[model samples]
Target: MKPALLLLLLAFTAFQLALCDRNFPSIFTGEMSDFNIETISKANSIRREYAKKNNVANMNKLTMSFHLITIAQRLAPECEKVRPGSIYRYVLLKPDAAAAAHEENLKLYLDYTYARNRPLWNERVRSMEQDTAYHLEFLVAEQRQIGCTFANCTRTVRDEQTLEYTTINYGALCLLGPERLFQGDRPKWYAFDEKKGDPGSACLQGLVNDDGLCVLPPPQRGVTRIPKPTYIPPSTAPPGTAPTKLETDEINDFFLFNELRRNWARNNGVSNMWRVEPDYDLRLKAQKLAAEDCEKVWPTENYRYFMRHTDKTNKEVAAATHEIFKTKIDTILHEWDRKEFENAIFRLEELDRDTASVMEFLIAEQRDFGCASASCARTVLNPKTLEYQTIEYENLCLFGPSGKLMANPPYNYSRTLPPFNQKYGELASDCGPDGIKEPKEDGGVLCVRKIPRISIEPRKPVAQALVMIEPKMEMIQITAVSEHSLNWRLVAILVCLAIMN
Candidate 1:
């Protein structure tokens, strides 16, 4: 985001106040809270690893937040009683044996009786002296455990040679055999019907060669005609406030006025698109958008919104979407050949961007499909022999997983992104592929067994590793600490956060 835009969004004033309110219902910023002092401490410890990656200024943001929070909590008397700069400079950058005599901390540490007063962080230090269990619990609390736990499971794993499988792990989720959810009956291979060339499509023809290089065909030139959505956008209102119904006679002679204005634009060609936003009433008959439709383009609603809101005549948005799709796909296609391509995968994966990877995977899968199906034989040019070899499959039907057909409602999703072209066909959750369907002729409604998903993740191009590590026995045990004990522990969390920065 541009700095101006970011500032406006963060500002208490401006239209951003409305934008900010939309997300206020769920605050996952992970800001400092009093929920758990230990949890905060663990988080602060992890935060330090990330903090070191940046400069001191970035680290100060974390400390400053703690400072602000503490300042806000203090009363006017407490503020007056506080020593200026004392908290910030408590830790000496360097130490000297002689200088230690001048510091008050030396006496507090040396004299146990005097230490009864409790030096600034005495109780907080004691809290850390307990067993490692406390730290483990704070890191991976029981409340967050899922998928697998140690109670019913042992270290035994499946022995492939003996064909014996272990079912101890994942007992909570996999009440049956462990492989029950892990195994699938669906055919693992599916590709574009090669004979039916995917013209102007982003799905390329290729494979990850034995050399570990992507040997894909160059993208074909020219754009195919883009398909409009099957669900015609209702004569609808854009975001913000919904549009109110306008009676036919709401504006006397409105239809005639609409027709006249449209005809004038038709006579003027490209020049008229700029004259004004095509009147929506007039647009009931207007086919395409002119330059003026850009104003009504509510971005986050997805490209479909643009498709519906645009005039079929407006070549600008359509051309833009096409170029965007091609540009993103081309970049991916090129990246596939690079050694550094693996680095493109982000830790916080993006389903939309990962679509490119899936498209390529589909292409690779199809390379085998032709040979796998008996009727169709695939001929491969062997890199080793430079001779073409024909490969064949015994009439097998390849089916990709259920996730390939995903229908996630997008937020601010761009339809022009690669793998989103209409040529790839509409992605529907309950339609073709792994989805169930009714039998033709309605001969006893068709039934397809639905597979239980083992994960919270859907079978999409972007998949996260669903993993949780069991904390040591100590962390799982929540021991109660006294209220006074909590005060300094909480203070330790605040101090650690500030000091870490």
Candidate 2:
């Protein structure tokens, strides 16, 4: 053989050897197993491997979320046919299906906690809301599919013999397992069919070459249309308060005005309406009083004095007053002729601006965390890392599971940040109080938690033999923590192959 050809062959051999030694294909395969394992020990092993690859003391929320996404891709029946970010969005926005098993266990715990004091009436009432249960189910089922493919691929393909079968993993979500809810059904948010030809479309055609690289679908496509919800204005009267006689005209006009305003707002690209507050107590009080003296009141029987008098046998008078007040609302709406309509329209515009201000404030407030927001999850589990940490006042992570300190700068979440575009999609746009700029092009930031760090003595090599050390049994005990570690390892292996090759 020629010297040049021999050198080239040697390099290829080295590359192939590296893949075998490090379990490259297994990373994706193992991720699939990580997704389905009920055993906590195995999960911890996987997560620990994943964590070590990143060299971070602990996985961040977004990393955890990515694992779940990885798992979902594997287990998700329609994962391949679905767009790239579709399953990710489905898990974060809706993890009912994937999380079904965990949620069911959670439900049991909750039931046990509340069993003693819970009223049967409450249960009966809850049963009436089937929609709520369906929504929850959707989340669990979807969560089940997250990060599944990575784990499964890692475990299955660790042996080269099975590498050929692994190509089945690539494709649109619809090409995966059981029929997905969205397979035949078109979702309003995801424009899968619309972007079939668009390069940015999440779903890409799965193509397998003799060389083993899983081709992902195209990038997101089209103008990235996101439909905003229509806002309905509240009544003018205060909440729980019926309209007082003076506010009757205002309340009556509100209903009619809202009808016209909504249509106009839709056309004008301003659909959010401001809520109107009305007084309920005053209206009820007047109604109760009028009802009690209806038969005794007469229209001409000193009605005005009867309203104010303490002692008056003016049941006839009371009746007259009630009729006059009843006509008040009628007069307001009917008498509104064209002139009143014009004035009401003018007032509505001003109200719309006020509504916008209120909504903006609400949108800003949503940035604060410890829960899932449109932007990120601070209170709830981090979708990326699957780790839960306290959200500081400025939308920063304060601590890790081992209580390692991680402090980020005080940031205005409302502003777009690098993480927004990369990690969070609509949420980044909707909730921007967390001072992150546009999502970084690279996606995640590598901020290590320096406090409460654990120092371990470097282990000595054992005659070229790899040391197989299991993570402390305790870590695997926790399902989430373990799952995270496993997911980390699988992702690391894939990443390593991509880089080295």
Candidate 3:
């Protein structure tokens, strides 16, 4: 071969290799630097917004994961086919060796109609965040990594009657992350801490860079560092001084309830709904009642109450109930879509029969309430054989002012009246209209009441108030009649219900 021809042939081969590198880079050793800077910044900005809304100061900014990017690249070819609007394809992929400790979130979008006018990456991300069905993943505080890739593809579709085929151009966006949305039965997307310090103070190493993000400090030189355990020990402060696990759960529940209430009211076209406030007195009364029994109970006149029971411990039952309630909200709203009622009215009769009436509690004018939970084990005796069995119960109770659910037929409802406005000599139209808005740490506002403060007497301690045992004995009979047995046996049992003292 001639020398000049050989050099030209080698040059052509090198150009082809460069093209392959740009089109489909090797996935085995990619890094965060592979993603665009703007993409990283925009994604982090959205996360920051959610963190602020959730009152979390230490939310970590997102970093791009190359493993996720490689996955996205591999799935990009699927965009050539069109899918129905109601169907979204979700594929779970195993993490690579480098990403073994990470979970994953994979999302794909194909715009069949937007071949000519593809949206910019920033706009596309915003659209993804706005989509109600898929937005939760982006809002999750623990999911702090993202990777995305886009592709332009064409699909060929055949007309059913005309016997013609046409090529349609489309754009596809694939997003990958180190975490998936709704990985567990958590009711909310973010963790809410009411006492979190200033912005970025919660970051690892307590550092915030120029972009206003919580970030970890750079690794130090020459020393091997041991990884710390994920669990942090609770403060050793005396009880009632430092927040307990139960108290944290209550705070989260309070935040979730108010947030859900506000969203529901807005969706249902109610504008004058007021935020409920936590009352320590009410909470204590609730705790006392909850420790009494495992059975469901209704509140008396002038107050509203809701109770939930589970086989779990007192600490776990509230979360379990919240998870169950969250799943029922959509169906409840759908069934009541056509109903017409006053904005602030709550009917106890409707609540009494509806299993999903927990939602009604949200709209109920139950301002100033507290929640309490308790667990106990009871022993049952079989009188016939002198056999005993143990059963456990957990209960959660919320007690508050009932909006008036015991009146006459249709008018028998509780109403949340607006707070009186002294400046204008009239009731405030909304929580913020009369300059009585109480700002909360979670970026929410509450309506303030102007009545003179009255001292509330403290109730007896929970240990003393709890009902330990039933004074009366209840008899139960169990009949055993089987096809294989020639005779029938009857067993008599005595149940003495008791709660932990």
Query: Cα deviation of 231 in candidate 1 (Å)?
Result: 15
Best by lDDT: 3
Per-residue alpha-carbon lDDT of candidate 2 for residues 59-105, written as tens digits (9 for 90 to 100): 21112334444335444443333322322332211122223323233
Off by over 4 Å in 1: 1-317, 337-435, 438-501
lDDT of 1 by residue, 224-265 (tens): 111111111122234443333221111211211121222222
Give the deviation of candidate 1 from the true structure as CA RMSD. 31.1
Task: Single out the weakest 10-residue window by summed lDDT for candidate 1.
Answer: 171-180
Whole-model lDDT, candidate 2?
Answer: 0.25
Model 1 Cα displacement at 112 (Å)?
Answer: 91
Model 2: runs farther than 4 Å from truth? 1-43, 50-54, 61-83, 86-362, 365-501
Candidate 3 residue 22 C-alpha distance from true site, Å: 14
lDDT string for model 3 (1-501, tens) is 223322332333332233224433333333223433344554566556545544556666665543334444555676454221111112211212211111111111212212333454224344433232222334444444454554444445333224366554423233433233332333123232222655465553213542345653433333211122121112222444645555454443444345444333422223444556556666677777666663444555545655444445343333334433433332222222213233222332444333233543444344555667766454434333355544344545453555343334444111221211111112223544342433433223334454423423222221221111111111110110110111100010001011111
Error of 3 at 118 (Å): 18
lDDT-based ranking, best first?
Answer: 3, 2, 1
Two-way TM-score contest, 1 vs 3, winner: 3
* Candidate 3, superposed: residue stretches over 4 Å from native: 1-165, 168-294, 299-323, 330-365, 371-395, 402-429, 432-435, 439-444, 455-501
Give TM per candidate: 0.16, 0.18, 0.32
